[model samples]
Target: MKWTDINNIAIALMDLYPDINPQYVRFTDLYQWVIKLNEFDDEPKRSSEKILEAIQLAWIKDAD
Candidate 1:
């Protein structure tokens, strides 16, 4: 999955970290977790603050 795939990334995160609190996650932490996902194949440099924030927000919704 690429950085632009926010919904899929968020869903993966929700499943990977079921107990995580999205409200408490930092972007740096989120970035690391995302890159480590087995399905995540894009370069880290392709990501930006906007994408990260979008993923975080989506993950928050998924968590809810």
Candidate 2:
């Protein structure tokens, strides 16, 4: 998945870290986890603070 695939990445994050609260997640940790996702394949440099924030927000929604 690419940086824009927020929903898909959110679902994966939910599955990968079911006990963690997305709202409390640090961007650095989030970035590492995202790049490690098996289905994810993209340039790390492509990710930005805004994109990470979107992913975090989506994951928070998914958790709900």
Predicted structure with the largest TM-score when compared to the true one: 2
lDDT by residue (1-64, candidate 2, tens digit) is 9998999999999999999999999999999999999999899899999999999999998889
Q: What is the lDDT of residue 47 in candidate 2?
A: 98
Off by over 4 Å in 2: none
TM-scores vs. true structure, each candidate: 0.96, 0.97
lDDT of 2 at 6: 90
Kindly provide the TM-score of model 2 when superposed on the true structure, using C-alpha atoms: 0.97
Clash numbers, per candidate = 0, 0
RMSD per model, one decimal: 0.6, 0.5
CA lDDT of 7 in candidate 2?
Answer: 94
